[model samples]
Structure formats: C-alpha cells, structure tokens
Target: MTVTELAFFVGASGPVTAEGTEVINQAIEVQTEWSTRNAPSMPQGRENRGVSFLQQIEDPSVYLLTAHWASVEEHNLCIAAPENRETLSKIPPYFQVDKIVYFHLKDVAINSTSGKNGEISILQSPIISVGRLTIAAEKRQAFEQAWNEVKGILEEFVKPNVVKNGWRLEKENETTEEFVLVAGWPNLEKYRDFAQAKDFERYQSVLASFAQTRDLKCYRRIL
Candidate 1:
C-alpha cells in the first residue's frame, strides 16, 4: 500500500524572504541527500522515496509537501534519520514545523464494485480536503445536474486505475457542494495528463456555465 505524509511550512515569526528561501532549499537538500545515502541501510520499512511539493494560493509562505513511500515503515525511517535530525534543528529559524500527519491512502474507486458509495479508510490526520462552490439559489438543480453529469463522465470515460477514490457531498463546507475526486498514481505525470485529457475537458464543460471557479489543494499527510 502507498502511504503519504503532509508537511506544512508555517513561518515561525517573520516574513519569508530570499534568505529564507535559500535556507529552506538548503534544508531540503541536506535532508534529501542524507535520506538517499542512509535509507538502504535502515530497517526495511523506513527507506526514503521522494517528496512531492505543493503550495496553495491562500498563503505563499505556507507550503505543503507530500512524500510518497513504498510502505509506512520506509517513510518513518527517512524522517528518523540523522540528516533529517540536523535539518529539523534548522527548521525553527525560517519557519515553524506546524505538525506532521500520516495517512494510509486507499483507492476507493478500485475497491468499490458498485460505485454507489465509497468506503475510505482515511487515517486521522491533517490532510483533509475542502472545496467551496458558489451556485445561485435558482440554479441549484442545474448545478447538481452539472456536477453529477461531470462525475458520471469521469467514472465512465477515465481509466479506473487513474482514480484512487471519489466522493460527492452537498453543503460540505458553508454553502458549497462538491464532487471530490482522489487519485493515487506511480507518479504525478500520469495524473497531470489525465486532467488535461479530452474526456476531462468534457466533464469540466458540464459545469462551465454554473461554476465560478474551482479551488483545489494538495496537502501532505503527517501524523
């Protein structure tokens, strides 16, 4: 099973600057270098794979990095290594380590034979996804139709392996209703291509008239 870790970079006291950027880069470099060299010698589960970085629009200073792993043990090993220990010592200077959350992500679509309801064994962590939508009151039905149609298209046309899990919720956050899609792939390249595929274009077209904008976020899971 594939595991995930969400790392959040929250500035401890001041604004992030050029100096701060360099510091952060150096820290990552040191940590990654050490992990690459030491992972193989560590216990079976704690080896290092690589980290996938992502940042949201709300705050540029605040960043998210997701590190994928062959297994939970390998993920744990990398974090506990000596290089990561040294890097941790430097984190407070540039930013505070908010918290580290861990997650055992499951492919809900693959496990769902009927595709009516998805069962996600989500680990209790900080990597929760929230989406907000603004739909006119008079066009509520129209909005729902659009969302469902797009979801149906995604389910039918896109390859099942491309999507890990899918969920639909009404009034999930405030006034927004969203159909959420989750995917787990060997690499980001596969997901990026499918997002730009023709079928995906058609799915988005269904919601084009009613959608104001779609906000997306990818968070690292830390526990």
Candidate 2:
C-alpha cells in the first residue's frame, strides 16, 4: 500500500520570522531536487513517489514535510541509501527536528455535492487541518472500523465545505500508536465552521473511545 511519511520540524527558540521561513522553504526545495537526483534504484512494488512542504498557519514556527511513496519498504530502501541519508542529514540546520512518522492510507471519503477534486493542494484549497491521534494498540481494529463508518458521515456532514478528507495508520513506531486524518477546505472560515458543527463533536467522541491522545492543527502551504 502507498505510504505517506511526515516529518515535523519546530523552529529554534524564538518565533520564526519571514526570513527564517524563506530559508526553510529554500532548503526544502533543495532537498527535493537533491533527493530526486540521488534516489536509489527502486525495489519491487515501489514506483510512484512525490514530496511536499507545509507551514502551520497558526504557528509559522512549525513545518511539516510530507513524502508520498509507493510503499513503506520503498521509503525504507531510499532512507537506507548512503547518498540519501547524507542529503537528509544536511536539512536539520534549517529547523529543529521534532518527530518523524509514517502512515498508510486507509480510506478517502469525498463529498459529491461539488465538482471540485478531493485531492489536497494549495492550488485547490487555502487551509488544511491535520488531526493526529495515538490509538490504543488493542483497539486498532475497532478504531479502523469506526473510521470506515464515520468517514462517509464526515463527508456528508462537511459537504461542499471540505475539499478532502482521508485517514491513515502509522506504518511503524515504537513510542506510540499514531494515526493521521487530514481535511482540506477553501478557507479558514469554512474549516472553523466544520469544527464547530455537531457532527464533528460526534466524530471526535467516536475516535476518543479508541484513542489515547489527540493533536489537531491547521497548516498553510508554503511551497
């Protein structure tokens, strides 16, 4: 299955100024270029891949680097390569490394009311909400089942307001059980409207039953 890898980076000490943001964006662009040139030969079941960079709207000091790979093994192979590792190691000076997590796409629910595509992109949407949770190991199955049931409801509830909605499970992590849900909207007001809706509360309640902790934040595309 396809996997999405997310790396969160926090700015050093003080607030990240405009200059700092520019530097970080440049670094990400450079990294993308270098990775594409130095990528190791792909193993079986690994072909399509891409990467993106995002900055938090509420907190410019936080950035999220996203990678879409054909599969987790493919991503691992690239990470294991000496050239890739060396290139990646040079990125840390741009920001403080917070955490790296991987996720496998579970399902995607799209609202039928609008003709707009559900794919998340800055060109298509102005705001994005990233909801992260650590689910109990024993309840993983139940959590996924609940998501299957709730995703459609979520799609209907948000209707034309949401551009994209999808869920993903953590690929592998020893410290915690994590899952990520991302929703895209045309603007902050529309997103805030969804947050304040009763359906969102119900959705959260269902997730809370299986989750140990949750963190949700909004981000704007920077590059």
Which one wins on lDDT? Answer: 2
Question: For residues 69-155, what per-residue lDDT tens digits would candidate 2 score against the true structure?
Answer: 556565566667665566566555555655433445532322122456653442235676788888766677788888877777566
CA lDDT of each candidate?
0.48, 0.60
- Lowest summed-lDDT stretch of 10 residues in model 2? 41-50
As a whole number from 0 to 100, the lDDT of residue 91 in candidate 1 is: 65
Which pairs clash in the backbone of model 2?
A: none
lDDT of 2 at 209: 83
Candidate 1 Cα outliers beyond 4 Å, as residue runs:
13-15, 38-50, 98-223
> Deviation in angstroms for 163 in model 1?
6.1
Model 1, span 1-223: residue lDDT tens: 5444445566655445666656656666665665556555432222233343434434555665544444557656766877777766766667776543334332232222344343221222123232334555567677666676666654453343333332232243555444444433323454346577667877767656775666555333321
Candidates in order: C-alpha RMSD to true structure: 10.8, 5.2
